[model samples]
Target: MSKVVLVTGASSGIGKAIATFLSEKGYKVYGTSRNPKNIEDFNFKLIALDVLNIETITTAIASIIKLEGKIDILVNNAGIGVTGPIEETPTDEMRNAFNTNFFGAIDVIKTVLPHMRKQKSGLIINTTSIAGYMGLPFRGIYSSSKGALELVTEAIRMEVKRYGIDLVNVAPGDFATDIISRRYHTPLFDDSVYKENYKANLDLMDAHVDTGKNPIEMAEKVYKIIHTKNPKIHYKVGGFLEKFSIVLKRILPDTWFEKLLMNHYKL
Candidate 1:
């Protein structure tokens, strides 16, 4: 039987690409959106699931399990983008980001684990971001939320290994997606000290996404990982410089790396 797959946040963007690609590849793919009805002509099944809502997460997972009898793979792609200066960004917004991007992913994993453990086989691929590897200007909250999830994946993978389940993080660089419009921007305040610089960086951020790689690249990577018998804890999919930036951070000294980023973002 073809593997049963669940991909959250599949209403559009990378999540949609991944879901559609896998369905084309013959997997029993089920995608999620906060409002499924709004999405029409989707190639695969779309379920209503708001990652921040535990009840919805549980319901979605249970419905999949009821139909498929087992969920062979889970793509934790449900998340929102949050951009702002840490100091000026409201505490509530930061909390909201963590709640959805971090805790929300965990909740889905928690809900699905029992079924996977019983089957003694499962693969979970998390859609993290290249930004998660470091702190970037104006995108700090977005970076932190994804970064936290990356760390949690590192820890949880080991804990779940004995149960014959695998967890992997797929961090992609900016992709041409609707995320730019959907992302929350902590307003450009008229009197804020960092207003000018923040606006510049925000435009830079938008440009990156506009010129980003196709979401299909990420979908292909996920497909490859699912087929691998032994996949690594982390896989990054993006252009050369974006992937190399992670390497630069590793080899360069902290201050030097920070300076490099400052120059790149023109801060």
Candidate 2:
């Protein structure tokens, strides 16, 4: 029997890439979206699951278990991008970001843990971001949400080690995806002090995504992790410089690293 895999946020972008690849590779793949009913083009199974809604999360997982009898792998790939100055961004929106990106992933993991524990074997791969490694200018909230998930994976992986359940984080750099269109962007008020700098940074961010690596790179990375006997706690996928930036953060002083990022973003 093929392994059952659940991938959230699979309606497009990196999630879609991972789901489609896994399906083609012979895993029983169930991809999810906020409105799976309308997503008709996917090559694998698509299901309705809104990460923010616990009911949907439970319902979807139950449905998959009923059909497949077990969830061998879970790719927690659902998340949204949130960008704006710390002062200018609405606190409510920031809360929403955390609710979806951080709390939401935890809810899904919590829902799945019991079944995995019963089975005595399971793997969970979380889709985080390269930005999660640091506080990026104007993208602080997005960074924090993903960064929180990264740390949580580290802590929980050990907690559940006895259960034979494995959890790992896959942090991807900017990918050519429609996330910019889907993400929350705080409106720029004409009188706001951040308006000018925010606008410039927004363009820079967009351009990076517009020219980013193909999403398939992430899919490949996830596939490798799934098959590994003892996967590492963290894995990163991206261009040379993007992956190297994490190393730079480790070796360089705090001020030096801050200067490097500022220079990259032209801040």
Scored by lDDT, the top model is 2
Q: Measured by TM-score, how close is model 1 to the native structure?
A: 0.98
lDDT of 2: 0.95
Number of colliding residue pairs in model 2: 0
103-163 in candidate 2: lDDT tens per residue? Answer: 9999999999999999999999999999999999999999999999999999999999999
Candidate 2: Cα lDDT at 131:
95
TM-score for each prediction?
A: 0.98, 0.98
lDDT of 1: 0.94
* lDDT by residue (tens digit), candidate 1, 179-244: 988899999999999999999989998998999999999999999999999999999999899999
